[model samples]
Target: MKISTLITAAIALAATCPATAQETKTVKLRILETSDVHGSFFPYDFIERRDAKGSLARVSSYVNRLRQEYGDNVILLDNGDILQGQPTCYYYNYVATDKRNIVSDILNYMRYDAATFGNHDVETGHSVYDKWIGEMNAPVLGANIIDTATGKPYVKPYTIIERDGVKIAVIGMLTPAIPSWLGEKLWKGLRFDGIEKSAKEWIARLRETERPDVVVGLFHSGWNGGIENADYTEDETENTAKNVDGFDILFFGHDHHARKAVVKNAAGREVLCLDPSCNAVNIADAEVEITLRDGKVAEKKITGEVRDICNEPVDSAYMAHFAKEIDEIKGFINAPIGELADTIYTRDSFFGNSAFTDLIHNLQLAITNADVSFNAPLQFNTKLNKGKILMSDMFKLYKFENNICVLRMTGEEIKNYLEMSYALWTNQMKSPDDHIMLIDERNTGDMQKFGFKNFTFNFDSAAGIDYEVDVTKPEGKKVKILRMSDGKRFNAKKWYRVVMNSYRANGGGELLTRGAGIAKEELPGRTEYESKLDMRHYLAEKIKSEGTIYAKPNKNWRFVPEKWTNPALERDRKLIFKR
Candidate 1:
């Protein structure tokens, strides 16, 4: 009787164990993401003109290894800005015979799952984007971008992928400000809708129809403070909240910030949002582990880690491929255009002034034969060294296909433009001790209202002119001409022949249209041509033949130093400019 009872118990235990085993299975999914790649696929640094960290080859190997570990449970994605940077961009724009799309080749090799569009991606104009989308192996997703002509969406709003028996929904969103930021011609006939509304509708549809186990929001809208909006006032902060209603994970790009935060929607539920820094500087990896019960996920666990891709070993194969491409493009960039003195110019400095800006000013002045030339110190990819400049270097300074345009403006208009710069420049100065000085009217919840903090201008002696800046004085009155290289002072009444890019000539930059009145002319060539012409070309045509470039200070513009009388202004000015 005892033996029979024991046998019955053992048989019952065996049946229960098999039922439990059938119900539970552990599955691991690893997600590897890159956002705003900006054509830095090869390990070479365009600025330094040498081997730097972060190449598609290295990135590929890492992803390949991750895939090997997790098998089919790995997803590789790029958040956008893939079409414009370095050798890949140049080849696609100029040299490609069939326009095979260099970026597509690299991405196809890496096997990207999905990507959203970035504002820079639109800079190449619509035709390139159309070709890129057709060439890509993965689907491009952006719910907000709509065609004005057809009144239809350009790409799919979301995609459903099945991995390891798990249904995952992925949705993409481009920043709504792209239309305004990139301008109409580039984003012509396209409307960017509100993110919240578009996301809500898509999420609702995904949940109702697809019933995905997990929902991810991939976005080109970045975090606050990193990329400030154009119109940030004292009280407004840029919105960084991801209020997508029902997303489990949100991956972001564009702002070039690496931050991990949790955002809550109107429904009082939490969503995890993550953004990694740019330039393959670092990588963010996340894993989701799910436990199944009766073929359904009964429990989920999320773990994330940030890896510095630069420290890892460079993949030899991809590195070799990149080297070959770099060598091919070398001759195109290295052909000596001109020579310069032993001076270093850089665009990275956000405060005070830059010699690089001086070079641009000189170039514009020479190119357009303008009396007063101006250029915004845009932070391009390269840094100038003490010797001869290369063609690759030119590409780094000017990446767009923008042309030069000359416009006419009145003296009053010029003064107004200068006044705008003064207001923007001085307002950024704040005193930490005084609450009133620091109180920003543009605090829009997610962004700080420090406007034009990185403004500076400097002149090179060989380039052309000299101007005395009373840094202590208020901005509008600070600039006074001391002397030009030709020993002359500036004359406000004189109609100067100024040259600038077509974008800025047409008022692309704020407060830079002051000298657009006397006469207007459109240069036949684009800005890229002017930049590619190099110092050699410019000197061969203008300065070298003339033997010197000179600039003189104009004392006509003068004002009292605000720092001497206003204590608050003095304190704020000192504090902000301390760095």
Candidate 2:
């Protein structure tokens, strides 16, 4: 009699239950990600002063259309590196601090579900990013970023969302390589942990606690460790997704290379990985379908792709909404700063010294009063035509906001640093026709596409010292120092003060650590001085004070075996520069 009563109760309960719960339920989730969007907020470029090929304004149309169809099922995510690119951000970051940050207003307007912090965001310093964190509508997550005093995560580690009763959890982590790239003052009160370790721990904890159906890993990191070892793994994104379980999809950036792939984890479960290159050029998207039987998840399918935002038409409404702010930024960037005597080309830095790279080197030497200065061509394949120089032109001159540093180093160490730089920069030649630039052979053409074997921003050159790089000699034997530029006796054993961007002084390029044989931990003690603001600030001030300026190369260094190097250089130059 009691069993029969229970059956009657069950039948009655089933009759009153929602019809959808009784049937096989399927929920489709579209996860969209934008990574390394370094301030291409609008459809215009503040520095270039032209219509941008890709911008968030154009992406807004795509995003709005998806959301209209999918509603809340369309989950929008932003992987970091948003705080530092165009004057769009720089204006709000510094110029207009009295109001809420424009980035905050922009992200909130777009309805981003959650965001992560990139190394560049942290480079904005505590005053900037800390304020940005408070203004964000959604959580700014960093699972591996630990607070020293509290011994816990600094930002929200993960966020959970429910779409049609399907639980989706997204965990965020930036590169643990910040210490190697940024100064301590920028990332004060926080410490970074290895991404793989943090990933494994968080996945297990979330499984035990949240029991989410889908897991996503959003990382502002690269796919491979480049020229760095023993200190930290710069690119732990792939390793974490391959080795760790529970992650269904992973998104990464920071190298600004776009790709999508599927890899099997330790449990032999497939995990989808994707990244959109920087500057809103592309957006990473993933489609997932979950089948539920009897209220239990039965099966799941996932696929990933990168969509081009360049061709998308700008959302007129979106552009109109930010019109006032856009016009203000335009006025600021276009304001004249000074006059230039001659045009400068960044391509010239590749073969030898050029006015483009030397302008920065000269500024660093003058600002720090150091005996030697090291600089690199940050803005690759760019140019500044000789004429009235605007504030925007200054940005083209110095791409990143990096602090300048003065360090005490022996003459021998400086040469060794150059040796390592040249090793990554140029190739040894045997014949007059042999290539000198280290072009990536795996690319379409060894020299046609101009794809270097390494990052061009890391190709460092020096001023204040006269040196010769022999193309015929091997890597270590290429550099030979004579007298100083001023004709003073150069002693290899003597120590001299050197000026360089904080990125180099902090071992961002591994020039000082791996090349000079200085341990990564010991770099802090060698620093004699470091600028409080970016070197561009001083450059702008100097230019404004002078009103007019002449730009020229130091011409203190050159590649030897010119007979052999010259022919190859010209050949490669034509292929790269299209001359």
Candidate 3:
């Protein structure tokens, strides 16, 4: 054959044959994260009887758009804390147990790739979370959570997701400090490991076994330097992102703080860390571009930001899909419970004695019939108006579903506990004009949303004891116990039954551990009595049986040196409340 003919035939065959597939391909990943949702599944708030600013429904609209834009590359993940907060979670968690939890339904409907089990999810106890997990379509990842019965991970430790030949390994972990807040009964048969250690171990094993192009860490704990107990801290996000050499991107929640940060790992690789805070207000977004050459990762670039879900339009389809459940929740929350004889405001609880904390205090004491009751205001500023008290009003009265507990505490321990509580509660007044409330300088803003240095929920007051708080006095010397409210002599050596919430008895606010000088490990054995039902249940029943609720402050405690404290209280209240 002629050379020209052969060349023409070769060109014709080349033109007819299929082109070579491109080995250098670019895969774009849009990682959308929702953390600490806390049961704002719908766009409405049953507790407040108002529309929520942001919720999963609004988020669903944006998530749908992203799914359409990126298709299979859009990965949806929840960083836990989905089982508590609003009335929806409470009702589904304990009240409406026969049906599927709304949380599980929302997550499954949104088609979450994975989710972590948060401490609050454990707060619902095994019966709820276990069932919820089984109902979810996606894997519930918890590398740190170990089932003591099987001596293995209670859920999937990590999940490997593949998109366009690019593999992504996601390792999920929770804070090991759950025991510090939740009682053993709630988190029974399971133990949580330190976040950093768990992440490192999982990353190491994944590297050894699976060859993933990208590694993602989905953590339920917060960033560094919080709730330090024993060797590990409550938030290991920073520690793990800095020291752990494997993870390319890390997302953490549980502290309920919105943040987007980058830290250089020990290997000099920059790792993106993002926390979208609580409520469904924000969504953490990470955009990753993977360049794959010959089916292997060649170059990768990642950038993260906090997306405002409030800006997203509410998804009508999402809302309509679960309208029945939403109506049921509303009906359950709006049901008539009893009647409030008079209004009780949480604002009054901040200064000295108030009807808000007293109501809970009385109920705690009544529930356990303990010698003394310890309580605090959970909500920052809210008032339950006079007249009808609906079932939802109970949420305003008592925030969480913590069980009533009575601890065998010595009188000295109680005094020390009160001292710690006041130390965390009030500011050290150097003079009459000095600010009385401990303002958190780091957290202060134009709104001064939360001026209190510590969480107000930690500021506990005694119900059965007459005591004085000298704001001028130092921390240890501030609280002076006069006597019991019933005119009984308070002996420091006497063993008194102290009634409080399970959160306190389990060392949540550190009133029992740090304040009373009792170690955390020994707290489980200190319980004298623990109520089977939540304190709110008893309160609801009590109110229903009585037909009318009448509660007022007993005025068992007061701040001393009225000359300095009285004026200071007024000034500080204005400053803190921004009135």
Candidate 4:
């Protein structure tokens, strides 16, 4: 053949054959996640009645920017806790009682790709959540939550998304600790399973069934324990990632923490993990660079980051779109309930006797007419300035969906219950400089540094007994019940009716079971009465009927050894109140 013919033939072969550039192509697939949002769709803090730091509106701004930069390959997911947090969620759940809640509407508006149920999401009860599931445009997922009738996942376990010929499989798992914390009525007909076990099963199934290029774990749990060998629980997202083999990225929430890291999975392969902190405060971002060879993934590079949304520009279009709904929520929340003759603040409740908790205690005693009452400051930080009280103020006073109950208990049982309350309330101080609060400072650090060790909802106190908590004394001996508020002798053997919330009656905080020596199974038998309406409702009615409410601490309890206690209290109070 001629040299020209040979050159032409070689050029033709090169053009027909797969070139180096044709063999491989890179695609940037970004996954943006919002976990434990707890219904912070608007930037407004409904409780405080002010503009707040975090919201989906703010996250939407970041999402819009990311979409602009990355285009159609970006995926958005919410890690749950959406059904029951702010006033908007509360309004829809209880007050309005719509077929499709505003929360589901808000999520649908945000165009969530997929979501999982947080334990709190289930706490909204079956009626609300069941209807909510129907309203979502995106699939709501929870592989671990099984329907009793079908013996399968109550919701979709996972979703497969194919973007530009690249298949990405996302599996969702919820924390299995719902049964431990919530009543059966809340999570009725559904059973929660362990996270690690569920992930292992689902990951294997996804790989075998979907044959996806990438697998993602959308876990509404925490990154705490290492693996399933020694540690196992519902809040084991980290354990699932370490023990499960196929996942490329794990987005976790619940326990309301913020973090980002790449850790080794069961096969000793790097897996990206991201946690967006609660209340829409941050966005967990997983950016993946996938190198495709012959229409399949050849190389995968995953980078995780937590982006703080504080003071960030919010999406004005998103905010404007939801303006009417926001206004309706605001109108509903701002309606006057009654008037407070005096201001009440939650900060003072940490010091023992406070007007804040006394308000709750007073309402419980008035309605139930029980000989004793126990209540806690549910809000960590809130203040009701004197004068007209609105529905929003009622939420700040008692934030949970708890019913008040009257429990029949002996004086001895009451003492024991208070003992447990005080033990968790204050630590036994060997020295004045030692921590007054039972805080894990090493792991938790300062509240300013690491946030509160315990949520303020758990800090309970007695309101019907004249008692003293001697911080210097040991745990069991610290609570000294001098007498009843009516000056009756505190007889240990005599039976007395007590009014407390259903949470305590059902063994929340273990005060009744562990402290009072009441069997967990036997707690239901001791309840003399239980309110159908929530405690907040009763409080609101009482205030409304009277038109004017006087708020004052009964001074039913105090910490003893004022010299040692005073200094420690002062230091600790300053430390906690710094923020």
Error of 3 at 105 (Å): 1.0
lDDT of 2 by residue, 325-414 (tens): 988888889889999999999999999989999888887787778999899888767888899999999889998888889988999999
> How many residue pairs clash in each candidate at the backbone level?
45, 0, 0, 0
TM-score comparison, 2 vs 4, better candidate: 2
Query: Over the stretch 128-174, how does candidate 4's per-residue lDDT look in tens digits?
Result: 88888888898999998999999999999999888877899988998
Provide the clash count, candidate 3. Answer: 0
* Window of ten residues with lowest summed lDDT in model 4: 442-451
In order, what lDDT does every prediction score?
0.58, 0.88, 0.87, 0.82
Cα-based lDDT at residue 180, candidate 2? 88
Error of 1 at 403 (Å): 3.2
TM-score list, all predictions: 0.75, 0.95, 0.94, 0.92
Q: Which predicted model would earn the best lDDT?
A: 2
Best by TM-score: 2
Comparison by lDDT, 3 against 4, better one: 3
Ranking by lDDT: 2, 3, 4, 1
Off by over 4 Å in 4: 1-19, 225-234, 442-452
Give, for candidate 3, the lowest lDDT window spanning 10 residues: 441-450
